[model samples]
Target: MRRSPDLHLPQATRASAGNLPAFLAACAVAVPVLLAVSAGNIADPIVRYDDYPALLAQPEGFWQKTLTEGRWLNYLWHLRGVVTPAWLNFVLFQILWGVTAAAIAAAAIPPGNRKWFAAVLALTLLPAPPVFLMAPWSSTLIPGFAVLALFAGLALVLSQRALRLLLPVFTLLAFTAYTTFPLILLAVCLISTRQRSLPDLAGLLVLFGASFAGAVLAVYALNWQVHGVFGIPLDPARSPDPAQDLAELWSHLPLLQETLSVLLGKLSFQSTPVLLFHLGLLIAATAVLLRRQPLEALYLWTALWAGMALMTLQVLKLGVTIPVRAFHFTWILYAVLIVRAAQELSRSPGLPGRLARNAVLLVALSYLVQTAVQFTRFRDWQHETRAMAAAISAQPGPVYATGSILDHPAARKAGLHRASSLELLTGLQLSQCGAVPEACAHLPPRLSSPAPEPQPQARLERFEGANVLVFPPRQ
Candidate 1:
């Protein structure tokens, strides 16, 4: 039997409804102001990386084929035009992803528990964590949007009315339209829970399944359009053996940790108070879950285990040794756990238990303060991108980007030649390289056929004639 939301609640319980004014006020101020500042300084240097070059070069045709075909239909990106430095436009949108995290924390808790709601909101908005710093640059924007979709799903589940349930579905669809992974994971988690009804269960499964299928199709279509093959033709030059690749990633792990630690507030871990503060919160959150919120605890534990297991193979293959990208997803599961912890805290009637919970609040509050301080660094770091773009823009001759920027409109408009790397630019003609490669020397022999002679000095030589913009992210 389905339980109505209104009938299930305690009389004193409050939803986040009353706190709207404050939350909105914070979001309204923070999201725009930060974007505006970044726009004033940031430049859209979408010419350096894998997806960036392709997307910028053909945003519309790409997305159009994507929807009609099945993958990152570059059509929309092309239509959107090159995301330029318009202040608080797309550049700022990247920063705003954090708001979704806050909103999820907000929706995960019952509205009645105003304090926890505020805490979650504050925590997310507080600062950029080590996870955001020194890792894949996309963290500034991507996860926040994913989180917003998540909170919307949560809202539907908790809503007392039918209309409210529909809202989550709409939100989920929107998010699914944007990015499929988080919402897919969220749907999996939601439907697996015992509390949901058949309709709730069925809807999520269908949506996730269909979207996943669509994405796969889109990718195939993209391969077809770019390479004239239904599938991406294996390029021996680009593929690397997964096992050996794994070794390279392992060698880089220590550096990754050091970068993360710095984001956590340590030049060195030995005496950093910031390290102690976060470690303490982690302990507290763990203890509270183990002691009281066992179900939620189990969910979080499963999410971590599953996420780690799933990402491990990709990490090993892709050579993405760092855990920052994985952490972004894990954090949401943790946020859900925190909500459960807060729920348990509310249910405890004794003074000692209440006081212990209060201690948890104090610690959370402290973490929030630390987070805000660290987040300010993101605002500062935006300058580095602006500087890099300006340097390339000022350079003579056609600009060619090797990584994510090739897809961006700005680089394509600048008539940049696309290549997998500086070495490739020196060695191959644009027609020879094509949109996607026919032979990837970087890939493993099993995945592709090999044998492009090492262009020993080609990488250095390529930049001699053309301008190359390299951010050379910290390893």
Candidate 2:
């Protein structure tokens, strides 16, 4: 009886068998801590943002409203009615994100590249994109789902029997779940097509096109079902011009550049040592790619360009400041490129290989330290928010809260600003905190006079038969 080829270990990867115990131990220790860190404010009864409360407020047929609003059929939205506890949502979100990241690492990285896999996993836990830790929104998890769907679809296309049958169903669900799925699928298919047979590659390409078309049709059907068949607009209102939009995007490029710099610890928050560690890893990766698979590196560069163009178009159309969460796909691509480069470098003999291994170690260490700092800050914010919510809940009569508590140095360093952070903390169903005017249009009139200055402490006041709580900027 012969075993399947897929089950057989490659000669290069056989050495990793010795490290399996170490990898498993690291995962066992790290995954729970990551979950705990991400679950910072989950225990707070107050909901975070508009969508959750809005959905909860709907009387019946809430799914219709959600569908009409052009929110992709995200799994989280459907769970609104079923999942009662606000914290449960965050817990499920962290778990799903963890599973998706692990699956992608397993599928994308070769067995011989176990060290890169570990590094990718560690980076996945880090708070480079602050929204993943600070906001309990489903959009933060979309990229993780996109990665899972892409890898699973690739397996299906490559004629893996079990995945071939399973992934088409998964693809349909994934495509409907996130608007970003199409762009991610395009990038993944383009990058994964190398070294495959021509016939199989052609089949994969066809599958990609078909899946995209199917996604479009599904969205239309959902819209038509909610609104009437005639309600579906064939041509939506067009933007002023692509040239104008591109110019606007160019003006905002500096903000995006600064964000990238911060993520790499190159600028702001003063983490120069961490920046140097990242530089070492990137330089080693580039050296390995140039020495070995230059053409593959070229393809990766092209994919990066395509991904960035798609993301920029989205930003321009929305006219909102770019959120760090939007860079999720870009991070996934970078991880894949680095892991491939590391694999090639690992096979090198002598000092180059040793240096490459050390670079990986340093990169992992830097991320771990950075993540620890971020977790502490997030936990502090969570505690403050919980206390504020409790105070608000204890007050009687119509309650109105003013000002923002997220003006703390740690929140600013984590890329959260006054407006966005306020939105996340206010407008809860359980608490007396009324929605800020900017978040929801319908709110009880304010009964308290505006403070002489934004308060520096969270305090409750009584005015005009209403409870007014003013949360001051964190001092």
How many clashes (backbone N, Cα, C below 3 Å) per candidate?
71, 0
- The candidate that achieves the highest lDDT relative to the unseen native structure: 2
Candidate 1 residue-wise lDDT, 1-475, digit = tens: 9876667664223343443543454355445544443342244322223334333344532433333323342233345545443332345344445355444444445444555454544454333343333222331233334444455434424433432334344433343233324442452355225344557445644554565455455556655776566743323443433446547767645544543544334311235664575456556667887886555555556555554544554445443333343345544554455445655666757774565456555544554454334344434224434554455446554443332333333333333344343322232232222234443333333223212332211111124455533222112
Per-residue lDDT for 116-218 in model 2, tens only?
Answer: 5554544443333443533445423443454554463344234343343444555556555545545555455445444534465456546655765576576
Worst 10 residues of 2 by lDDT: 234-243
Off by over 4 Å in 2: 1-30, 36-47, 54-69, 113-135, 138-171, 182-206, 228-280, 293-303, 313-322, 378-381, 402-447, 450-455, 463-465, 471-475
Deviation in Å, model 2, residue 349 alpha carbon: 4.6
Candidate RMSDs in order: 11.3, 6.7
* Residue pair clashes in candidate 2: none
lDDT of each: 0.42, 0.50
